[model samples]
Target: MVLVYGHRGAMGYAPENTIPSFRLALEMGVDGVELDVHMTRDGEVVVIHDFTVDRTTNGHGYVKDLALSEVRRLRVKHGFGGKWGPVGVPTLEEVFREFGGRTRFKIEIKRGGDYYPGIERKVVDLIRRYGVNAQVVSFDFDAIRTVRELDPNIETGIIFIGRIRWFLDIARKLRVRWLHVSQDLVDPEGIEEAHRSGFLVGVWTVNDGEVARRLVSMGVDDITTNYPDIIIKAIRGA
Candidate 1:
């Protein structure tokens, strides 16, 4: 059976990566939840998609420059408006404490331009501390490699946007067990080859019922969707 992962904790229903959002995902009975993490100025790991809080929250400025106190003060914006309310940015520790052993987690490390130094180590430490079934994934090859170097026992995956000629070979070189591919780039032939090579496949941001059914039939290991309930229903109906 294919696993269903809630993308940013049912982002379609609640603010992405907030406590309420994650709780809703758990309520939906999703197999797992995927969230993005970035380092705050105080060296704290907070859950939010972008490097800056401008798009998702009422705050302005880069996350890397904001202390945890300032970050917590900012309220998350609801649905493309300036309506900032109660939901604040959550820390990695808070998330672990809330849902840690209850479900699986695919933590995407958001890196590039002012990326957090030693974030992989911090993330690995928390995962180990919580003992949650989780995987660290990043588009940055070095980030994934850093995870392996720090703790080979920790699972890691690579996220890619477009097609690559030797994707599996790259995965093997990196010693990653899963590939988080973009939905448009997924092909049955590629998925079959990946499975045959002992690699798991996960597609992201998939929300349509027909597309969900098609991917499930193609034998994807996990489908990360914003609407976990919808995807679960679609998969069951299939």
Candidate 2:
């Protein structure tokens, strides 16, 4: 079966990475959700995309520079004209507590290693504490490597935008079972190649029904998208 994950929680329908967005994705019947994480100065893990809160929220300053309290004060800027109403940045723990059992999670570590020392450990600790089904993934090779080091049992994935084979060596070193590539890379040959190499392929940000159908036919293991409902319907041919 081809699993569908909400990229930043059905971002096409709600504010990306907010609780409302995640909840909406769940309502739409996504198999899981993919969200980005950054650590506050106080060592709290908050969910948001950019390193700075300027783009998505009515706030300023880097996430690393702000304390958890400071992050809580900023309301997320909604795309649907305040339909989500005064949404605040949520902590990873908060998300886990509320929705952990409800859906799987693809937790993307925005920065790890030197940039966010011990972040891998923090995320692993949360996953363990919450006992949720989740995978740690990142664009940074070292980050997911650190995640593997922190907990070998935890599943990890490499995210990149390029040819499928470009990250194979790194994926091998990390021993990751998932290779999450950009939507542009989805093809029958690449999917077959990845499967032959003992890795499950995951494609990202696909919204069009035709494209979704193509990926499903290509034997993709996972599809991450801004619109899970559309992809769900597309795959089911509804």
Best by TM-score: 2
- State the lDDT at 126 in candidate 2: 100
Off by over 4 Å in 2: none
lDDT of 2 at 21: 92
Q: Which pairs clash inside model 2? A: none
lDDT of predicted model 1: 0.89
Model 2 per-residue lDDT tens digits across residues 1-238: 8999999998999999988899999999999999999999999999999999999999999999999999999999876986777889999999999997999999999989689878899999999999999999999889988888889999999999897887778788889989998888666787788889999999988989899888888898999999888999989754
lDDT of 2: 0.91
Residue range with the least summed lDDT across 10 consecutive positions in model 1: 77-86
TM-score of 1: 0.95
Residue by residue across 1-238, what tens digits does model 1's lDDT show? 8899999998998899998888898899899999999999888999999989999998899999999999989989878344324788999999999988999999999883237987888998999999999999999888998889989999899999865335888899999999889889999888888888889999987999889999988888889999988998999862
What are the Cα lDDT values of the candidates? 0.89, 0.91
lDDT of 1 at 37: 96
Candidate 2: worst 10 consecutive residues by lDDT? 185-194
